[model samples]
Target: MGDALDIMQIAGVGAAALVTEMTRSSWDSMRDAVARFFRRGGEERAEQELRLIDTARQRLVDNPESGRGPVEERLHRALAIQLEAFLQAYPDAAEELQVLTDRIQGTNEGDSGGRTTVHHNSDSQIVIAGGAINASGGFHYRAPEGGR
Candidate 1:
């Protein structure tokens, strides 16, 4: 609506909200809040939008080996379009959007936020809960041809 960058920003915000909220236990409330922001056709419309959110989650879950980069990119495009259209219809929703943004950020800042970690060999990643992350010198190994 505004410009390429502006629309992308709106889309990024939407994507971030979707990413953050889908993991949270209070997902329904978060979904309802976002729906209310658009003030779309009411509760039913909001529920429909929530279905989209669920689809996004499924994409991430179903494509673990596919890497998150490509998945996130696709989501960004879809969410950006949705956000741009929604904002165009309800410019005042920016404040409501901020409310969700702050809440997610605050929630993450507490015990529920993201932490940095790198994992090897296994399918799990090491997560830092409350303290600073630590690392040592790099380690690398070459699998012996057909050996371990």
Candidate 2:
């Protein structure tokens, strides 16, 4: 909306949000936020965008392999193009687009609104509550390729 480069950058951020957040637990909220942004166009346009988002998510759910490969890249490009066109049509919505993108990034970073401190010495072991673990002064063994 501001310029060709700015619009493309905004679209890239939007597309990255869609692609990366689609498989995460926050996806429903992310999708709804995206729909709200698109709703600037109109009800019909918002619904159509929602459908496209859902279709992309469904593809990932139905075929997990595609989520990390060429299919994912294609989806990113498609969404970026769609968003760029939308921004071109509605130039004033660029600010809201940036806010939404920031929200997605913040959510992904686990916004707990507090500081977490970890104190560890060379021989210390630690485990955070949410699926994170560190073992110090030990031989580390990697898992097998196929979910061992």
Pick by TM-score: which candidate is best?
2
Pairs of colliding residues, candidate 2: none
Per-residue lDDT tens digits of candidate 1, residues 1-148?
3554564575568667677556557777876677666555466766776677678877865776448767877876777677766666666665566667778767767754556656474533344456455558654445458654
lDDT of 2 by residue, 85-122 (tens): 99999978889999988888777667545476776544
Off by over 4 Å in 2: 65-67, 111-148
Query: Which candidate wins on lDDT?
Result: 2
Worst 10 residues of 2 by lDDT: 122-131
